[model samples]
Target: MDLKRLNYFITIVNNKSYSKAAEKLHISQPSLSNAVKKLEHEVGAPLLERSTRKFALTDAGELLYTRATIMLSQMDIMNKEMKEVIVGGKGEVVLGIIDSLKTWLPKLIYNYKQSYPAMVFKLFDVLSVEHVKQTLQTYKSHAIITNQLIYEEDIDSIPLYKERLVAVLPQEHPLSKKTTLSLADLEQESFIISTEGFQTRIDIINAFKEEQLKLNIQFEIDRFETAVSLVRNHLGVTIVSENYVMEPIDKTVIRRPIDHPFLERTVYLAYMKNRHLPVAIQQFLQSVEEHFSTNKPL
Candidate 1:
């Protein structure tokens, strides 16, 4: 099969619909359909089972889909390598980071750029751990800086740092008087918590259970800022990573680490283990390690 047809096949699998893939590639639907048909004929098997309701890939199609993803990625890497030979290692670096990580990332990116003047750095705030894992799996990002580790067969992680979870309470709350309170002390206390799917949520919940305490979740918010804001208004308390507790401290909000469970979140730099990273990204990784080793953010 032609490389064009293979590229089209990868797009179709990614979009999950021939029509949607056609629209994205700016090609006519009939032309895209013909390409897939010819590909199926050449393979002597149907790649996609088309039904009135939805598209499903057959077993052979699923295998081909996985292999095609890697093949296309390798081809793209080869093309970039050829270009880099002429232009040097000066391509864009796409980094996916957890939303809460923005606090100190500016410093890291600044240091990286000073060292590698030619590479353009693009930072994207990925909201969830699963999203970062998906980006790594699909070659959407060169690297991910995140607080949570997601289990994926193809991805590898480098340990970066640990972030402790601190309790945010209104300055007037009775719990604010304690320098450090036990998780058991917060049992039945009203809390503004992040939604349940987050791995951080799981960590907090497990910690509470270990302390024989039950969390009374008053509100479920998606953003870390929302949870902090609510606690500032005296709505309830919330558990948040230390990196998120930036100051000029709101006079109304007080932060204290929980002493009983003593929970801390680990941050990792994730990338596809087998994927060949561009030279610019390799230099960036080195700079990141150097920045974190000596500098402690204020």
Candidate 2:
């Protein structure tokens, strides 16, 4: 299969218009259309549903698109590795990490850098596990550190650490003195929470549902820091990973563990299962394993 045609198909799908894809690809609209038709013939199926006003992919098209994305990503990695080999330099490793890992990820990277001094890094602080998975699938990131246990055929995940979730409250709040909290305790309080699609947010919602309670959500923010800051201001209480409890926080806020059954989540380090991982990535994975083995929470 022609990689160029596959790229054109991807561009068309992304732009959702033939003319736009042609313009972006610096080719004529007719030529682009013809190329797609040829591609469809080669694949023995109509890849697109062009009869409707809005463009849509056929079932076959969706499959091809998914596979082509991975294929192109692999090609890009191979090309970069080849270039690095020619230049006699270690290649780069891009990592996508969730916000909760911010505290420890730097130290892990620092340790890895000692072993692979010439390796370069690109870090993406992603908001959710979905975004991290997408980054890895698109080849924008070589590995991801996330709290969500992703079960995908092409992806492999290793458990790194487990942490409980706790309710963060203003020090002056009545619940601040409590050793443990429950969903009922927070039912009347205004809640500061992560936006939808985040695993923490989903877990919070589920915990509320389990107790047959409705949360009085006041704000939906992206980062844990924002949620914590809001709680510190007494705007609303929020739930956060226990890792934040270990951080040096403002005296105005306190964290209380939720009652049984407790809300605990495990963090995982994930990567593509089939990709030929570079030495730097392999060593970095080792560093992560070593760090957690010696330093994991009890």
List residue ranges in candidate 2 displaced over 4 A: 9-16, 30-74, 80-89, 294-298
TM-score of every candidate: 0.80, 0.81
lDDT of 2 by residue, 111-227 (tens): 777877788888777677678778777667778888878888889998888888898999999987779888899999999988877888888888888888999999999888899
Q: What global local distance difference test value does model 1 have?
A: 0.80
Off by over 4 Å in 1: 7-37, 44-70, 73-89, 99-103, 150-153, 293-298
**Angstrom error at residue 98, model 1:** 3.3
lDDT of every model, 2 decimals: 0.80, 0.84
Clashing pairs in 2: none
Leading candidate by lDDT: 2
lDDT of 1 at 200: 75
Predicted candidate 1 versus true structure: per-residue lDDT over 1-298, tens digit per residue: 5888988998998888888999999999999999999999998999997764677898879988898888888787777556655655667788987656767777777777786777887788765777888777777788888876868878887777887888888889988888998887788678887785676788888898887778999999878788888888778888888778855567888888888444888888888878767667777876766666776662
* Best model number under TM-score: 2
